[model samples]
Target: MDKQGANMTTNTRIYLRASTDQQNASRAEASLLEFANLHKLNVVHTFIENESGASLERPELFKLIAASKQGDILLCESTDRLTRLSNEAWDTLKQSINEKGIRLVMLDLPTSHINLSNAGDDVTTAIMKAINSMIIDIMAAMARKDYMQRRERAAQGMAKARAEGKLTGRKVNTVTNDKVIKLLKAGTHSWSEIVDLCGVSRAQVAKLAKVVKAEA
Candidate 1:
């Protein structure tokens, strides 16, 4: 559903997101609402999450992906925020959207809006899809390269700190972990639920929550 959409009449599921731990999430919504208003469409839902776009899996993004229907329009503030990962993952995501018959909207990429409505169903549209897909492929590659460069710089900084013997690696905070115990003993929450609530991944949560349960 990576359509450059046009004249969308259906109520769109406007997804606004910021892929950082500290960055503000509200900024994604302001202009998207204006676009929806201008197009005379209703925004049925908005999901915002403070997570990295490089994360191959995200809770809110998955929920939105699964919830999308034939006529659903998945709106995002920008394409890079949807995925700034490897092209393979991006391809899978796009394939999933196409199979589900969803539409994608990007304020930063207006041509994507037209791809949503009338493009894929015709020969001319098919040609346009290829060209646009190529552009997206190029963009995704650049994003991956930039991600690698950033990681390299961060690694160099950490290495220097380690050499200076002044840097310590992150430790799991005890007080923060204690809340995971509270969630499990007081209510019937799933392990995954505990992970989300604790803002830790399931793998780490499994190791910790199990110990807390055994002691209790």
Candidate 2:
């Protein structure tokens, strides 16, 4: 609604994600809302989810992307929150965003922030987009590296705990397992839909499928 730097007005979609359920996904919502207001960008959608950045199965993020159009902004708190995907996954996501012509603006990457201005000059806009794309690529790589390092460290710690006889894997959630089994046995919904319905992963659904078949 409000005109920003380039005399062009566009809506912004705010994406907030946390790697685990324990983390508060919407913790940065207020700050992002303030940022949008200060920049004169009208925020049309706010999608928040607890999802692993290493995977691209984020339903909410995809919904936000699909719902957006050219000239619309995709705002995130940081690159890590947006993605810690492997190179291939990151490339896929980047391609989709570019193909949709959505502008990605991350707070941690100030280089992208300036590109959102929509300068009204084709040449300047093109230059900025190219620069911002490179910056995004580098940031995504760093995020993925950090993700891998953290995972490695955690794995090492678990191994040490196991060696000391102090490690025990998390208990399966029987309630969720039961729900997944029921959904799988019904054979009505797709695996992805069942995952969402039962709040379980596809791997869990596969495991339950075996149990259901064996019992049938």
Candidate 3:
């Protein structure tokens, strides 16, 4: 049987993110829904976005936070999905969640899984909160480190290519550009929807929109 808190609400808000439009931000939706169902959590909303986790400018994430009330659970697939922000940004995000009285539950973190269950005695709950906070901080730091390392490696690769005189900038995908133009002309999809459906960045879509407008 699923445990329920007698005095608290199990309201949950799910946040899912992918670093680029090429990745499906809703990839974890089904699994997370299943998890919520298994725990008998009342899923209030699921916010999906293709935004870099390293940045704190994500609109969808903040929307989820704003919609949450005290005792609401902010569920995520993992800590990395929740944050790959710098220490300062991560601290700010944590402050916002803490201030909102939100309980963050990450599926990959076993320590956090207990959060879905009924609350224990006050002392036990406090100890778990401290432990979970420490582990989440460590994981967030590691995620940031990984992001920095990948960026450094990409820079090194670019530098090597420049030195070798093989640094031809990214080639335009005429096929994708044509598709984006068609979608923009259709005037049916939002910028974000086009980004997801066409697997192109917002900048690319905006550029295509300009071309379509000029032709019109």
Give lDDT tens digits, candidate 3, residues 107-129: 88989986776565598888988
- What is candidate 2's CA lDDT for residue 202? 89
Q: After superposition, how far is residue 90 of candidate 1 from its true place, in Å?
A: 2.0
Q: How well does model 1 score by local distance difference test?
A: 0.70
RMSD of each: 8.7, 7.9, 9.2
lDDT values, one for every candidate: 0.70, 0.82, 0.84
Candidate 3 residues lying further than 4 Å off, grouped into runs, are: 1-8, 118-121, 169-216
Q: Report the alpha-carbon TM-score of model 3 versus the true structure.
A: 0.74
TM-score for each of the candidates: 0.67, 0.73, 0.74
From the highest TM-score down, the ranking of the candidates is 3, 2, 1
* lDDT winner: 3
Using TM-score, give the best candidate's number: 3
**Candidate 1 global TM-score:** 0.67
Evaluated at residue 57, the lDDT of candidate 3 is: 62
Per-residue accuracy of model 2 over 1-216 as CA lDDT, tens digit each: 223345536778999998666679999999999988888787878999987788776899999889887879999999988888899999999888888878889977888897567667587777877887888889889988887887789879977987897967876688889888777766689999998888887888887775554320
Positional deviation of 89 in candidate 3, in angstroms? 0.8
Query: What C-alpha lDDT, on a 0 to 100 scale, does residue 23 get in candidate 1?
Result: 67
Q: 1 or 2, which is superior by TM-score?
A: 2
Pull out the clashing pairs in model 2.
Answer: none
